[model samples]
Each structure stands twice: as C-alpha cells, then as structure tokens.
Target: MEPHTGEICAHSMFESEEEELAGQAQAWKYTFAFVESLAVKSVVLLGIPDIIARHGPKATLSLSQIAAELPSEKPDVNCLFRILRFLVAKNFFRAETSGGANEVRYGLTPASKWFVKGGAAAPSVSMIAMLLMQNDVTMMAPWHHFNECVLDGGVAFEKAHGLHLWDYAAAHPDQNCLFNQAMACNANIVMKAILSKYEGFQGLNSLVDVGGGIGATLAEIVKAHPSINGISYDLPHVVAMAPHYPGVKHIGGDMFREVPSADAVFMKWIMHDWEDEDCVKILKQCRKAIPETGKVIIVDTVLNPREKTALDPSMGLVFDLAMIAHTVGGKERSEEEWKNLLKEAGFPRFNIIAIPALQSVIEAFPY
Candidate 1:
C-alpha cells in the first residue's frame, strides 16, 4: 500500500462517484428531515385536508378549486402549489394532473384523512393544534441547548424559556391549552386501541386514571363498560376543565399524596416525565389505592434494548431523548429497570402487554 501524500477529506474518502452520491444523499436527507415536519404543520395550518374533504368522497380538487375554498381574500396559488407538491411526495396528499388540465389537482391520502376537521376520522384534539404544538417555537428552542444541557446538567426547557415547562404553560394559557388538546387527541387514539384489545379492566368494578387531563379517555371507557365506573384524577386546575361525562367522574387531588381508591389504577404517559425515585413514590401511592387482587395499569414505552433486529426503534429513541432534554431526570427504561422499579414500589411481579400503539401496557399487582 502506498502512503497518502495529502490529507484525506470527506470527498477523498469516497472511492467512487456512486459512494460520493450515496453519502451526499444520506447527508441531505437528514439535513432536510425537518422540512417534512414543517410541511405537515403547514398543511394543517392551511386547513388543506378539511378543504379537500369538503369536495366530497374521493374528491380530487384542482389547485384553483382549493384556493377558492380558503379563507384568504386573495390566496397565493403558486406558493400553495409548491407546498402541496412537497406534501404529495411525502404521501400526505396525492397529486394528479390531466393532459388537458392546466394545473395539478390533489386529494387526501389515508394519513391526511385524519386531519379533516368535523370528520369522523378526526379526534377531540384538533390536528391543527397538535401539529402547531409539536413544532412550536418554544418547544423546538430547547434543541439549541442540547449539548449545553448535558454538560451543565441544566433543564433545557428552563434554559430556553427561563422557567420550567409546566410553569411556562401555566403563564401562557394558550400554549397550555394547545398542549392539553394535543394530549387529549393522542389519548383518544390510544384509548380506542386499549379498549379494542386489552382486557386490563376485565371484571374490575372501578378504575381511576391518574393524571387524566380532560377525562375524555376514561369517559369513553365508562361508557363502554357500563358495569364499571371511571374517575379522571389530576390537579385541581386540570380537572376543572374536564367535561361532565355520565358514568365517569372527575376528582381533583395530588397523586403524590393520594390517588382515589379503585379496583385498578391506570396511568398513561405519566411516569416517563419523572425520575426513578419519583416513579417509585408514585407507584407506591398507586399500590395503596388498589386492593391486593387489583393491579396497576401503566401505558408507556417499554424500551426493548435487546430487540436489535425486530423493528425500527427510531420513534422510541426520539421520545427517550425528549425525556432527557425536557425533564430534570427523566428517561426511557429497559425491562430490567421497570421490574426493579416495580419491586421497589411494593409490587411483587408484573406482566407487560404489547399494543399496536406507541406505548406498552404493564399490569403490576399490589403487594
């Protein structure tokens, strides 16, 4: 082998044109990844999905037709066309242009169908609110301090906003409402999946959903299982906003102090926001709330570290990093970590059930 005379740069490392192009493709794909998210947000903001849906079943509307449906007095057709084209490539919408048609037409895909407002496919948490919150300036600003947060052991959200997330939201009611709406929408999807498959509530007379924000999730459950009653328990302020649903009652209190006694305690997406010690405390409180025969139902991501070949866990890692960046000491956990937490919290054993959703269900028994 001959020694290299010059420094090996990124371009020099690629042996062939094919390799260089491949590297460039991967690099540019990542660089432009956020564009897809922003595109989704834009589509929601413009109410394109709803507009297209109004055109009737399997409707295909031309660019001019879509523009006519918009609220703007003078809609920018050219820019809107550009955005529609991008979304079309991402499969959020389908594009069709005829030989005689001067402009391209678009139609909704299955994914985009969920964004149609007042459509049966849409959830309580509007798609517009959810998209805006996910890509919000306040939330995304934390990523700028990603490295600083690790080195300084500082809360990234606090560093970005000069206050904790909850405090910031409390001060900004609009943002808080947006966050809650997104959560409620997400819970609606998850709750349907839970009822369809899981038997966690079987034969149980009562279930208390801890940190149940608006009672929408449990309200559906109480209606589904008329023999059982449900309670949505959260902080006083959050519980105040819950709508009155028959068979499902709302209670205001602190989970750390006490959770309303029930045959089963259900908590979803709550533990990942707290550290290990805090989780133990919360689970212990849940243990006290349920009887010996009853169990605690937890719906959260269960990190499958050992599943190296089964499925892509990129979504799981995204949430895990989010916990790190957003919380004081929160993180996703492996199965071993979950077991240890359960044992420490006075639960002798537990069973984890897989669901088609983003989170798993863990049924842990009382001591």
Candidate 2:
C-alpha cells in the first residue's frame, strides 16, 4: 500500500521494529535516570546495604528475608520485591534463584557496597555524600531552577535560596552540620589516597589546610607525620563547631584576606568552588603563607577528556555540572586551566602528582 508524502510509514521511519523498540528503551532510560538515583537513596535510607553486609559478602537474601529485617512493623513484601527487582536489573544487586521454588535472592554488588555506612574495612563509602546531595531538600531545591541559572547566567543555588551557599549554610545549623559531615566523608577518602600516593608532605615543618572543615584532613595528616605542625583554617562559625584534634589547631579566617603562615599550604577541593579571580586571590594568600622554599599543595580534580581507564572522567563531568547548578562561579578545570590559575597567582612553577583516585595533587611554588 503506497502512502502519501505526509502519511506515516513505520518500516521506512526506522530500520526495524526491534531497532525502534531499542531506541524507545534508550530514551526511557534517559528520562527515568533520576528515578534510579531515588531508588538507590531509598535503599540506603532503608539500610538494605547494611543489612546485606551483616549477612556477609557472598550471602544473598530472599525478598521475605530482607523484609523481616526492616524496622516497619508490617512491611510490604511486594513493594520491597519490586524495588529489589529494579535494583537487581540495574546491577546494584545480583539476583539468583535458589531452592525448589525458584525464589529470587538479592546480593550486594560492588556499587551497592558503597551504600553501606560505617563498614569495618578502610573508610566508609560515599553514603553521607549521596544523602547530602540527594536527600536534603535545601541542597536538591536548587536543581529545580537550574534552567533559569543557565539562561540568566546566575548561580542556581542563590537564585533558589536568595543567599550564597556559604551564607545559607551558616544560617541553617542542620544543613551546616550535614555539609561538614559530607566534606569529612570526602576528606577521609581524599587524604587516604594522598597519604599513599603523594610525597609532598614529607619534609614540611608545618602545613595549613585552607577551608578545612572540622579538621578531618589536617588531623589525618598530623597523625601520619607527627613532626609536621597542622593548622586547620576555615570560617569562624565553622571552626567554632570543630572538635579539638591532637597536634592540629583550628583557625578561623578568610582565605582571600590572609592565611596562617606555614611551611606549606594545602587545599583540597577548594579551587573548584570559585572563579579565576577568586581562585587567584586564595592562591596568592597561600603563596604569602609560605616562604620561597615552601610550596602550595592543591588536591583537586584535573579534567582530562582524552584519558580513559579505571579512572573515568565521567564523575568529573558530573561534578562540573553540579558546580554549575550550585556554586557562584565554580567548576572542575583542566590541567591547562590549573596551570594558568597558578601562574596568575604568581607561582613560577608547579608539579602535578597523579594519584589512584579522581583527584590529583598540584604543588605550586612561589619562587
């Protein structure tokens, strides 16, 4: 049957019925990506990962078994089944049939293991970070106005909350605490990676952690090298809430104004939160804090689009989008951008120390 020019022809429009279905399926995945994150959030809040961990790494639990562990007096078995089914399909968990009845048992995968909180081995995963980003209404509200920020060229967070992120955090004590906790979770991960892979801290007499929240990173560094005096510098209100750490002193100050003098200045994940001018200002303060023999240590992501391996750039790209949506003029930068930023701050030379993690260590010298 010949069709008119304006009439629809399914076969001609697509290569095959199967191919068209595949395209539709791919589109659905894109459309429902947020749902996947919400599902993971739900599982984390429900303590599913922790429950599975108690059963040991290799053990699997049937739907009924998992439901029994829930705090709910009368948990819905079918609803739990559907959530687990979806998570299993996405590889957050693995499904295996057991016994004569062909019952499906769910087991944790490596991805889901990150959802487990306060595990015995090493540092805990990004559960706190995920909660801060996904569960907090204050943090999530800015995303609703993300499009407006793109169109109007303003920070989405300020647009939504009518205050800067730092100011907003200060006004809201609960949000501030969560923010510090999230940063501490990240600091533990970053410091572990740095201690193993970076040698910049070997000979320093003193080190200052600019924008250090609650002194987590500084405490770890001081514990590792007892001879090196550690100073944790942050905003006044933030430092007021920090607990005292042995061999680490917390100082409240603005990095743009002045930094505590040290043999070396260390900043982790700070530069990505400001524009070039502001970064230059902070970097200059770091430079002023150290002598000609001293250097500035910046632990941050150096975006490289070409490199592909176990350390993927996808996370960096995602973080860049997050900065765009949340911060005033913050973003993840390339190696070239880092070099330029350092140079603009009067650093004559710098060295990049690559680590096994997503961030790299950049050591910038004043002379």
Candidate 3:
C-alpha cells in the first residue's frame, strides 16, 4: 500500500457525495434536535391543538382558518405556518395540500389529540411533563452547566440554581406545584398501563406508595383495588398539600428512615433520583416495612443498553443523561444493575414484569 497523506485520508472518509451529504445531514439533525422540542412547546402554549379540536374531531382547517383563532389581534400567518409545517413533518399534525395554489390544510394526528385539553380525546400527560422539562428559564439553565458538572462532578441543577432540586422546589411553590402535577400526570398514564395488564395488586390487603406526592397515584390504585387499603407516603410538606381521597390515607416520613407498613411497598420514579447507596438505604427501609411474604413493587424504567436494536430505548437513554444533569447520583439502570441493587438491599429474589408503558413492574420479594 502507498503511504497515505492527510488530504488523501480525508477524501477517502467521504468516498461518495451521497455519504458526505448523509454525514452532514446527521450532524445537522443532532445540532438542531432541540428545535423540535421548542416547536412542540410553542404549539402547546399557543392552544393550537385545542383550536383545531374545537372545529371537530375529524375536521381539517386551512392555515388562515387556524391563524384566525389565535389570541393575538394580528397573528402572523407565515410564522404559524412555519411552526405547523415542522410539526407536520414530525407527524404531530397531518398536512394535506389541495388546489393549484397548493393550499396546505392541517388536521390533528392521534399524537396531537392528547395535547387537546378538555377536548374529546384525553388531555396530554406529556403536556405537563413538557412544560416542566422544556421551561427555558429554569429547566434549560441546568444544561448550561453540563460541562462544569462533567469536570467537577456535581449536579448541574444545583450548580445552576445554587440549591438541590428538592430544596429548590420547596423554596419555589409554583415550580413545586408544576412538578407535582407533572408527576401525577406521568403516574396516571403509567398506572393505566399497569392496571390493565398486571394483577399483582389483586390479593394485597394494603399497599403503600412511598414518595407518592399529593396521593394522586395512590388514590387511583385505591380506586382500582377497593380491597387494598392505600397509604400515600412522602415528605411532610408534600403530603400536607394532598387532598382527601376515599380509601386512601396520606402519611409523611423519610423513606431512608421509615416507610408506611403494608402488604406491599410501592415506589414509582423514586429510585432513579438517588445514588446506589441511597437507593439501597431506601430499599432496606422498604424491606423492613414489608412482611416475610410481602414484596416491594417498583414502577420504573428497566434500561436496555444494546445499541439501535429492534425495541427503541431512546427515551430511557435520554433519561439517563437527564438524571446526570438533574441529580447528584441518579440514573436509569439496566436489568443487571437493578439485580445488584436488589441483592445489596437484602431482596434475594425479584421478578421484572414488562408493562405496556415505558416503565416496567418489578416485584422484589423479601423471601
């Protein structure tokens, strides 16, 4: 082989014009990925989905028709069209072109229907999640410190806000309320998926939702399983805000110290917020709360680490980075990592049940 020069190597890397274009497109896609999130946020805030829903379920509206309903006295049709056009490409809305002038009409896709609050279809769970997550002022600030966090080994949120996430929430009531609402929305979606397929709660006499905020999740569980006495456990401040729910009791305490005693202990989206040591401590507390026959039921993501396989785990992987950005020592763990945590926490045997949702149902038995 002939000796290779830098110019020759660089030319060989591209090989073809198509490969060069593909590489450039992929790079640009990653660079502009946040645009999609901002676009979705814009539509949600503008009540675009709700506006279209008012027309009718199967109704399609022209750009001018939709723009007419905007709150602004004079809404810019071109700007609105640009936003809708991008969303159309992403499949949030379906676009139809008609007439010689190529007039584009937009209709709600199944995905967009969820965002239509108070419409025929259910209100969006992600709408709440997105508001909290995509808030440029607070949530996005943490990402600015991502580099600092990587170098200094500290939470980006704390670095950005000068306080831990919990402390920050406590200090800011509105943000805290939004966060709780987001959690409840997420729990509602997950519980719906879980209750439909899983029967573990069928025979239980009682269940405790550790870290349950406002008792919303526990309330649903109690409603579903009338036989199971439900206890919602969380910090004093959080439980203080919870409303009265029939067949459900709200209790305040630290999970590291104690959890409410019950036939089974339940935690959703809690473990991923803490380090392994903290998780083990919480798990040990959970172990003590349950009886010999009792089990700890965990509703959280079981990460699949394989790259670009059949089942897409992009969300779980992104959540892992989110954990890094938001918490000191939190992450979405693989199945093997979960096993190690369980074993360390004194739960010798556990079964992971795949749910219809992004999170899996883990039953960790003390026996």
Candidate 4:
C-alpha cells in the first residue's frame, strides 16, 4: 500500500529535527573559544616557547629536558606532553617523533615565535600576561561586589581599591611601573602596525601624543620620520617618570585641563578609557590645543558588530569587557558613536584610516 501523506510529513519533520540539532552544534562554536586562550596562557606561563626559541631555528627539546629546566613542583612530564599536544593542534608549536617510539620533541611554530624572550613582536605575550596577572586578587576581587558598583553607579576600580585606576597608580609606584610596561608593550605592536600602514604622519611638522604613556608611539614615529617633532603629554607623575627619547619632548599636565599646543594631537587607545562625556571634554581640550588646520589623530578601536563574525572580533569583544570590568561605563565605540562624539566635541570633519593593527586612526579637524 502507498504511504499516507501524514506519515510522510511526520518522517520529514523528524529529519528536520536532526538538521536543527546539527545547526545548533555549529552555532555554539564560540562557547568553547575560551579553551584557545587557556591553552595559550598555559604555554606562556610554562615558559616552553621561550625555551624552544633559545634553542634556535628548528631546534627541538624532549619533554623530560623541558621539565628538568622548569622549577621544582613542576607538573608531570606526561601532562606537559598533553599540553604540548594541544598547542601543536593549535599550531602554536610543532611536535615530532624521536629515534625511540615513545620519545617526542617539540619545536616552535611561527605563532609561538612572538612568545620568545626579547622578541620584538612579543606584545601579545605581554598583554595576555598582564591580564592574567593583574586580574588576580587585586582586580578580580571587585567583581564579587560588582552589584555594589552597578548600584552605586561609580567606578569599579574605586570600589575595589578605594581609588580610581590613575589614583591607585599614583599611590603604588611598583604597580604604576607594571602598568606603564604593559601599556608600552601594547603600544609597540599597535604603533609598529600604524607606522608601516598609515600615510597621514608623512607631512606633519609637529605632533603631540596626548595621554601618551612613556612616549613609545611618538618615539617610533620620530625615529621613522626625521622631520617630525613630537611631544608626549601625560599626568605629572607619569611625565616625571617618563623615559628619555631623542627628538620627543615630555610635557606634564592634565588633558582635561589643557593640552600642549601642537600641529597635530595624537591619542592612542585613550578615549575608550573614559566615558562619553569625559571623552567629549578631553576631545574639546584637544581641539583647542591644535590649529584649525591641524588634526587630532585618535587611535582606537571602532567596534563593528557586523565584523564580529570574523576571527579578530574576539579581541574587540574581550577589550569591550575589559573596559567594563576595569573602568566605570567605558566602552569601545561604533563608527556612528565616534561621529557623534566628535561632532559634539566641536569637530566638524573627520577621516578614518584603518590600520592593519586592531586600532584605527581617526583624524578630526576643527571647523
């Protein structure tokens, strides 16, 4: 007998159910994305990449040798082997069989090269390391009382430590140094990408790096472009401790109060550290500091929701969370949000030049 229509429909419905389950599995891929970061952190803290890098090109170290080099209380060598196995799977390292069937030697991959000691491109290691370390008891402890922070509508860092980030930095000299190092390391990666890709800095006679910590970005720019004179502006404490650099002058003052006058003002990764109102106030000060013909070059992430599907959007999303956890009401901005902030701050026209790095160069001009 021929099959009835209702039975056929029911059979099709069951097939659709299986397909929906498959689709849900694919959609939940990001739910497991934290594994990659944890693996990277494990390799970093274990100092495996640095050891392989010290061994030179194509050099491989056996698991036992690696464990011997580590301090006492090391995890079992087999467990280390498992970690290396996962790293190999992630392409952070390469593993090969030795003469014996049981022996396996590990080598560094291109991705692992940056984690090598004294490597120029080691910003990711510095950044991840800082995040893992600083977010320990001192920082993460506040999150338990995050409800208080939210209810009080005040800065979380203050709630956690009884002062804002800047104030806390001023009081703790060692923590301040660590913060500067982290910022410098992050700036190194960003500025290197900017100097290589962007053309806007070519003709500028003078530039000011507003909120520039230790002048890392400006120093690179001046070294690359001989004709450009630069200024590194920050708070008094930061400026007093600023490292010396040829051709870049250090200026100490509050950006909200006043900025040193210059042909162009550069603010890298600074605006997102403050709220919209605070950003507007700082931008207004920046507008007054530069000439009408001069530009205010802002280096920050332009959060694009559409681009969240891409590989690097994880970095953007992570940074957005960092802002929330560390600061009060700070956030990464969208293009429209940026435009409104600029316009509200009294800037008439602006141009966005996308750097190959995570941040973009936003040049705003006064009317």
User: What residue pairs clash in candidate 2, if any at all?
Assistant: none
Query: Which one wins by TM-score: 2 or 4?
Result: 2
lDDT scores of the candidates, listed in order: 0.82, 0.85, 0.85, 0.80
Supply candidate 4's per-residue lDDT for 109. Answer: 78
Q: How displaced is residue 346 in candidate 4, in Å?
A: 1.4
- The CA lDDT at 52 in model 3 is 88
Q: What TM-score should be assigned to candidate 1?
A: 0.91
Query: For all candidates, what are the clash counts?
Result: 0, 0, 0, 0
| Residue 317 accuracy (lDDT) in model 4 | 74
Off by over 4 Å in 3: 1-15, 98-102, 124-126, 305-311
lDDT of 3: 0.85
Shift in Å, residue 236, candidate 3: 1.9
lDDT of 2 by residue, 1-367 (tens): 8656887866677888899999889989888878878888888889888787788877799888899899998998888888998999899999999899999988889888777774522344455464555457888788889778767778888888999899998999988988888888888878888888787789888999999989999999999999999999999989989998999999999999999999999999899999899999999888888998999999888888343437777789888877876688999999899889999999979888887778888889988
Query: Whose TM-score is higher: candidate 3's or candidate 4's?
Result: 3
Clashes of 4: 0
Q: Which sections of candidate 4 miss by over 4 Å?
A: 1-39, 71-79, 119-136, 142-152, 305-311
lDDT against true structure, model 2: 0.85
lDDT of 3 by residue, 20-78 (tens): 99999999999998888788889988988888888887778899999889999899989
